[model samples]
Structures are given as C-alpha cells and as structure tokens.
Target chain A: MFCRRRNFVVLILFCYNNHRERFEKQLGEVAEVVMKAMELPELFAVFLKIGCLAFGGGYTVIALLQKETVEARGWLDNNELTDIMAISQTLPGIITVNAATMIGYRRQGLVGATLATAASILPTFILILVLTHMAWGFTDNPLVRKAFTGILLGVAALILNTLRKTGKTAVNTYADGLLALFTTVLLLGTGLNVALVILLAGGLGWVKNLYAEKRGAKKHGTD
Target chain B: MALINLFMVFMKIGALGFGGGYAMIPFLEAEAAAHGRVLLENYIKVIAMAQVVPGPFAVDSSAYIGFEAAGIPGALAATFAICLPSFAASVIISKFYAQFKTNTGIKALLDGVKPAVLGLLASAAYIIGVKPLYELSHSLASLTVLKAFLAIACGYFALTQKRVRIGTLAFLTVFALVGILFF
Candidate 1:
C-alpha cells in the first residue's frame, strides 16, 4: 500500500511538472475573461453588437447570443445559456431582450439589466426612427408609393410565412389546432380585445389541463 | 394624452405578448385600429420595415407606432413601455427561476398562448393580404398581377431558402425595382 501511494505521488508530480506552463496560461486567460464579463461597460458593448446584428426572427438571435456569450467570451457555457433561454420563454416580452436582461442581472444586478437591455434595443431603435422619418418624407412621391404597394404585398407574404413556422411548433394536438382556429375566428370576426381573447384562450387551456389531470387520477384509482 | 395612451397600449402588449415579436403583431394592429390613429396600411408597412431592420420586431413596431401617434417623445414612451414588462419579468424570474421554471400552470398557459399566437398571425396575414389580392387587375401588363406573383414567389423562397436575411433583402429590392420600372 505504501509503495502504491509512492507511485501515485510520482505520477502526480510528473503531470504537474509537464503541464504547469499551459495550466498557468489557461488560468490567466480565464481571469481576464472573468474580469471582462464582470464589467458593466463590456456587457453593454457585447449586447449592443448582438442587438445590431440580430436580424430576422427571434430564434435567429438565440444562436448569436449563444455564440457571443458562450463561444466567444466564455462568460457562459451551453447549459447555462440553455437555462437562460428556457427561462426567457417563460416570461412575457421578447426572448432576446429577456435573455440579455437575465444574463446582465446574473452578473451585475438591476443596473446591469437596465444597461444591457438598453444596449440591445438601442441600435434598432435609432434605425427604426431614421427609417420612419425617411418613410414620412417619401410618402408623397408617386414612385415611392408604387414601391410601398409592392412592399405591402411582401409584408403579407412575410406574415404568412411566420404563421407557417409558428404553427408548426405550436399546434401539436387536435385541441391546439381547434384553439388556434377559434382564436382566428374571434379576432377576425368579432370586436373582442386582443388581450382579452388571449386571456380567454389561456383560461381554456388551463381548464383543459385540469380536466385531463382529473381523468388520469380517476383512471389510476380504478386501476 | 396620446403619448400616455400609446404607452398604456404597448405596456399591455409587452405584458401579454407571449412568444414575442410575431405574437405582438395582432395586439399592435388591434390597439392601433381601436384608436384610428395609425392606419392599417401604415401599420403593415411598419411590419415590413421591421422585418428588414436589425433588432427585435417588437421594438421596431412600438417605435414606429409611437412615432406615428406623438412624434419623438411618443416613440421613447412606447419603446420604454414595451420593454418595461420584459425588464420587470426578467428581474422577477431571476429571483424565482427555480420555482417559476417548474410551475405547470404557467406551462399550460403558454401552451394555449402559443396556438393562439399562430391564429393571431394568420388573421393579421389575411387582413394585410386582402387588399393587394382583391385589387389585382386582370390585365397581364399591369403591375398589380406582377406584384402578386412576386410576393408569392418571394414568400416561397423565404420559406425554403437557407440564408433568410440576405434572401429577404434581395427579394425586397427586386420587388421595389419591379415596382419602379413597371409603373
């Protein structure tokens, strides 16, 4: 037993001696990144860039966020990002913004959350403001009007495309499909408030789940 | 008063627009129509612009709606209001993530909300598309038919194409050029 212990200690010393330089270098790199991620300014800058480049659907930004936070800077790992993403979905509002806020809050607190959220939306806000101004100026020109007509068609097409993608994931059951159809009819055919309609649909869903649970419990008791 | 109303409407949207961006469209359209401040045509245009621009769709739509209702202050107010729910929710969730993540009630609610969001998007699409499709002229030479054709073609490509961002921008640019020269 003593000889075995001596051999194990020799192996440990050999490994330590061989990899000491690389180990220290890795530690220094990790420390630098930890510092960078902890700083409020750095957090703002990263999220700002993320906002500026996060184009297309909300899902697209998730990849970019993961890339920036997990792959590039090492501030988070895959699992932590996944958790943030899952948490973001549970709350109201944009997933990307929610994610930014969560990550910032985790690192720094309310101020960090505010700063990160602001940075994420800043570029888009300015761009939209500028575009709106330009659109106002061009509203009267005949050619611009013609172009807008075409753009309107494109907008319709875009919405339909979104519908297709969202429906694929959301409508997994017959009840879910029926719920969607009911919503479409109510929103299109009635004067109901959109928020109220949404809440009503949610209530129906809750009731459905509750009923299903009761039935399952009854079946178990019978068994 | 206009700014306050705009802020309130968007705050509601932010608080309830589960699944975000695309889901917020119906709420924005309905609220804007309720006030009759921003025209439906204009709101659709804003959606198109939002698609091409960088950042979240919700942010762009709120900013445009605010700008339409009350200029710069309106824009700021709407933007801040729409974002406030997200900010507040994140803080709350950060505090209670463990419990929130496991809550079945919230899960079931979201399950219902998801399908309803799909429905909302469908209704909004119908509202936006009816005008162009209904007005398509019979003449082959007219731009309306061409516009309809191009829109469908663009949509088809948008669905199938791998590189969405560049493809979308290209399609829009082509549609614009076709509009300019054909007319």
Candidate 2:
C-alpha cells in the first residue's frame, strides 16, 4: 500500500509538470506571435498604407478603422466600434492599439489581440524609430533640421487643437473652468509636477462638487 | 550614475503608474528632482516633446524623460517599465471584462469615473495652453502675443463651430505655417 501511494504521488507530479510546461508554452507562443507580427509586411502593410494614405491623423484613423473593420471586413458593428473607442480612450495605452486589441480579441481571442496590437503599432514605431536613428546621424543636415522644425510646429498645432476639442467636451460649468484655470496656472507658472497637478485637480473637483451639492441643499431649504 | 538612477527610478514609476500616463508625471518629476539629474525647465521640455510625438503621449513622454535623464538604455528601461503595468493589466482585464459585462455595480463605478476622467482631460488642456501664452506674454513679443491670440481664437472656433469638421487642424496648420514662415 505504501509503494502504491508513492507511485500515485509520482504520477501527480508528472501531470503537474506537464500542465505547467503547456501553460508556459502557450505564453511563449503568444509573445512570439506578437513579436513576429511586428515584422509581417502584410499585417503592418494595412496599418502603414492606411495611415500614409489617410489625410487626417487621429480622427482619420478612426474612420479608417470603421471602413476596414465595419464596412469592408464586417468584423464589428457600429455600436461595438464606438464602444471600443470609448473604452480605449479611458485606458492607459494608445487608443488606436487599444481599439485594435479589443476588436481583434472580439474576433479571434488572445492571439488576435496580440497580432492586432503589433500591427497597429508597427507603422508608427518603425517610422519613429527610423527617424530617431536618422536624426542622430544627420544632426547637422540643414534640410533635416528644417523638416524637424516644421514637424515641431505641426506637433504644437496638433496639441493646441487637441486641447481645444478636449476643453469643449470636458469643461461644462463655471466651476470646471475655474478648476482648469487654476490647475493650468499651477502647472505652467510654478512648473509644478504634472502628477501633482492631476491629483490636485481631481481632489478640487470632488471638493467643488461637494460644495455645490451643499449649496443646492441650502437653497432648496430656503425655497 | 544618472542613467542607472533613471532606470531604477522610472521602474518604480512604472510599477506605481496605475491611473494613466499623465498620472505618472508627478512621480517622475519628484524622482528627477531628488536625483538632481534633470532641471525643472528641461523636465517641462520633456513633457512638451512627449506631447508633440506620435503614439501614446504619456509613454512617449516617459521614454523621452528617461532618454534625457540618461541615454538610450535609460529610454529602453523606462519605456519597458512604463509599458509593463498596462500590458499586464490588459491581459488580466481582458479575461475578466466579459464576465463583468453585465455587472451593475461595475457599470455604476464606471459612470462615476467618467466625470472624473473628463475633469482630468480638461485640466490637461488648460495646463498645456496656459504655459505658452504666459511665456509669450512675459517676453512681451507682439508676434508671440498674436500667435497666442490665434491659438485661443482657433480653440474657440473649434469649440463653437459645428459645421467645420477639421476646424482644429485647420487652425493648427495655418498657425504653424505662419509661425514657420514669419515667426
């Protein structure tokens, strides 16, 4: 009986090891697919060609995704696409990649998400990586410098535009505007940390909401 | 010393960066200041660079900070660290999201977070816009002032104007072209 129990323990250990190995192999495969998708021309070709061909940047990308995934491929519905966009923006990563991952996962599970993310990022990553390398080599090239200057100006414009749109959507009241203004002054004037600015803004927003609620209650009582 | 310090510091930042990239800025700034590796002005410049670059603004910004703090290795480490949490979170969350799709409490929590997210976004915009205008005013440059005014006007137009779809980009491109040519 003791010998039989020893044999049973050995069998259990063997099964556990097999299971662990299979799990590890699955994870390895996922990582490999993700990395390999980066170099796959067909995968990146779609994203790169679309990005290059498209006129606008951010919204254009959204439109392109709608066309490719919804209209052309019929991978997702309009509502699903919109939902993905909303969730993606709330998340920490790049919105485009986040959207791609969501759609991909919806279509083909974990492997799809990995491939889609790699594909979506491939174009920008390769372009920027190449540009960074080239910039280092051609540091003294006047044309390169001029082009960079132009790019910087373009970037500044893009940011300003983003701020405008974001402000319209985000700032709804006098209190919100004041909070924005206050946070802005603190950040730019004093060169306070961005993290601190965000925290303080969040805290102040909560406080303002409380104040407003209390004031409303008092007014209601008076009425 | 600087590079190694930056790698270690940003690794900590990445580990703690839960909310978003913007959420990581204060921690980054504190670490930089503590090390005396990066000056405040340069730190702001790094933020600006991150904003200008493509991809996720926060990740790019963190990478830029790491690079500025040390060099290439610093950039790699910082980027990796910053990206690690989101990557892990994504995998874990993806697994559970389907299960929680119909959970009312989760929905309510998400609703609560929405207004806060809006507030954060608003705060970011205001912070970014004010800096340049303040600097331009301090310099007392007419051209800078004009540019600042144009930015504000463009912002207003973009906000109020409904018919124009690309109003923001239009303002940006025009101002940028003008700045490049004249300023």
Candidate 3:
C-alpha cells in the first residue's frame, strides 16, 4: 500500500513539472516577441537624440555615438566602434550616417538601417526647416542682414581654416599640392560641372596609381 | 519638377561628396546654381549661418536649399535624397567591408580623389573670402571692414594656432554677437 501511494505521488509531481515547463516556455517566447517590438522604437529614440546633439560636423558625432552605444547602453565595445568608423570612412557617405546604418544593421537588419538613418536625419531636417522659415521672415530687417554679412565673413574664415586642416591630410606630396591647385583653377576658371571635375580627378588618380604600380613591378623584376 | 531636380542634385552631391561636409561646399554651390533654385549670395549666407547652427553641415544646407526651392516638401525630398547614397554605400560596405577595406584599387582612387577635393575646398575658400578682402582693401579705416578683419583673423588664429584654443562654436557665437552689436 505504501509503494502504491509513493508511485501516485511521483506521478502527480511529474505532471506538475511538465505543465510548468510548457508554460514557462510559452511565456519566454512571448517576452522575446515583446523585446523585439520594443527594440526599433528604442533605437529610433536614441538616434534622434544623437542627431539633435550632433553639432559641429560628422566627425564629432563619432565620439557621441561611442559614448552612447558603448558606455551607456553596452551595445558595442571599443574595437567594434573603431571598425565601424573605419568602414564608414572607406565608404562614400557621411560617416555618422554610415555608422548608424552599420550599427542598426548589426542589431536588427535592413529595417533597422532605414529606421536609424531616418531618425538620425530627422532632427536636423526639422531644425533647418524652422530656422530657414524664420530667417525668411526676418530677412527684411537690416540688423539681421548686417548680422548675416558678418556671419559671411566669419564663415569665410571658417572655410579657410577647414581648408588648412584638410590640406594637411590631402596634400602630402608636391604632386598632390599641384593636383589641388589644378583642381581649384579648373573649377573656378572653367566653372566646370563639379561632378565631372570629380570624375576627372578620380580617373586621373586611378591612372596615376596604375602607372606607379607598373613602374614598381618593373623595378622589382630587374632587381 | 523642382522637387525632382532637388533630389537629383543632392543625390549627385552625395555620391561625389567624399572628404567631409566642408568639402561638399563647392558642389552645393555649383549644383544650386546649375539648377537655378536659389540665389548665390543667399545660399552662401545660409552656409555661413549653418556654421553657427548645430548639426551636420550637409543636412542643414540640403534642407535650406530644398525649402528655398519648393517649400516643406522640397526640404524632405532633398534631405532624403542626399542620405540615400550614403545609406546604400554603407549597406554594401557592411556586407563586404573585410575585403573592401584592403582593396588597393580603391586606396589608389581615394589617394587621387582626396587632393582634388582639397583643391575644390581651397577654391571655395577663395571665392568666399575674395569679396570681404576686396572690401577690406578699399576701406582700411572703416569700422565694418575692421570688424570683419578682426573676426577672420581671430578665428584663424584661434583655430590654427595652438595657444589661443577656443572651440569652433564658441568662436562663431562671439563673432555673431559682435556682428549684432557693431556690424
């Protein structure tokens, strides 16, 4: 009688365990779906805030993104951030946008890419729209006009400063400097289409590279 | 029609705009002129103000240009169009970046393209500065020209020189204030 009672108790316990396991599994799946739903919105909010604070230019945003994603959220580590930045630099786009797309793509996929890109741009889009409209209304004011003129002078300085900084990187050799000068004259003097000018420059660069490579090969062959 | 033109113009700018925001200035000016959407001086002024405002230079300029062209819709179109190339490029790179990163051909192309971009930027700086310098030349004694000169000199010194390290935004704000008070 004792053995039969013990078997009955064991059977009840086994049934309870099976039901509980099934219930927990279903609950976990639901939770996962919910988390997936929340992720895109969370991504949008984070990037929108980043967009608002991404001042100065694209390069500055790299630090901002690293701070938010690595330190605050722990979505990425330092090495990943560096890799993303390098890839962004290699591609032909704004680094910030490229980084955002890459991060989003890593996290979710193509939908995330589109969402993050839109979020990153939305704040600037809105801010510029509002400022431009207001500036239009205020253009009639002479004080505003004077301020704009002054800003123009400041901008010229700023551009030249940028030119100085960029020139350091772009113009390494004498040939590069000459090429830069050639580009300036070609654009300003001829008023050529900027796109065509860029293509011409790229073609020139490729041909130059090919020639150098062949010469190097010949030197190596002789050696 | 204007919206389509704005989109195409910016798309071209995006594909070609390699160096950074500043490097794209010449392209923006040239495209706007070619499209005949905005006045040259007005566009330049917008670019100037953009320096003071906080955001990516490309996005801010695109919005203003689009708005000037066709109101709110134009702004949206241009902004989206400008970002499209970057997005597409990133997508492809994200997939194949391991190999793409070390490609010699791309490295060589970028090598040649970068100097040309610098040249383009230099020409833009000259175009922007020529008028102010010309005015300064005529009136060495005028307060307005002096103020403009002071702004530029101080900005250049602060940025390029190591000792007087003021931030770009801070420096620009002070000059804007100076403009309101004196210019």
DockQ for each of the predicted structures, in order?
A: 0.48, 0.15, 0.57
Candidate 3 local lDDT, B86-170, one digit each (tens): 8998888778877877877777886778778777676666555554445446765666556666777776776787767666677
Q: Show the lowest summed lDDT stretch of 10 residues, model 3 chain A.
A: A86-95
lDDT by residue (A1-223, candidate 3, tens digit) is: 9999999999988887879888788999999989977899988888888888887775678888888888998888999999888667545556678888988887768988888888888887788777766777677587877666666666667777877877777777787777788888888778688888878886786677767777987999999
Q: What would the per-residue lDDT of candidate 1 be over residues A115-208, giving only the tens digit for each residue?
A: 9999999999999889877877677688887776665566567767777777787888798889889998998788888899988886786677
DockQ for the candidate 2 complex?
0.15
Cα displacement (angstroms), candidate 3, residue B177, comes to: 4.1
Query: B1-183, model 2: which lDDT tens digit per residue?
Result: 766666666655554342344534446656556646434444544444343344544555555566656666776666656554445545555668776566544443333233344434334443344443455467535565565556555555554556865543454455445445544
Off by over 4 Å in 2: A1-57, A136-160, A167-182, A203-223, B1-73, B98-143, B151-160, B167-173
Lowest lDDT sum, 10 consecutive residues, model 2 chain A, at: A144-153
How high is the lDDT of residue A222 in model 2?
100
Ranking by lDDT: 1, 3, 2
User: Cα lDDT for residue B51, model 1?
Assistant: 70
Runs in model 3 lying further than 4 Å from the true structure: A1-33, A213-223, B35-38, B131-151, B177-183
Clash pairs detected, candidate 3: none
Tens-digit lDDT track of model 2 for A1-223: 9999999999988887879888789999999888656534444455555534333345666788888778886777999888777666555544555666676666656776666665655444444344544545563455543333333344444544555565565567877777667765665457666556555665666566666666887999999
- Model 1 alpha-carbon drift over 4 Å, by segment: A1-38, A217-223, B37-39, B131-150, B161-166, B177-183
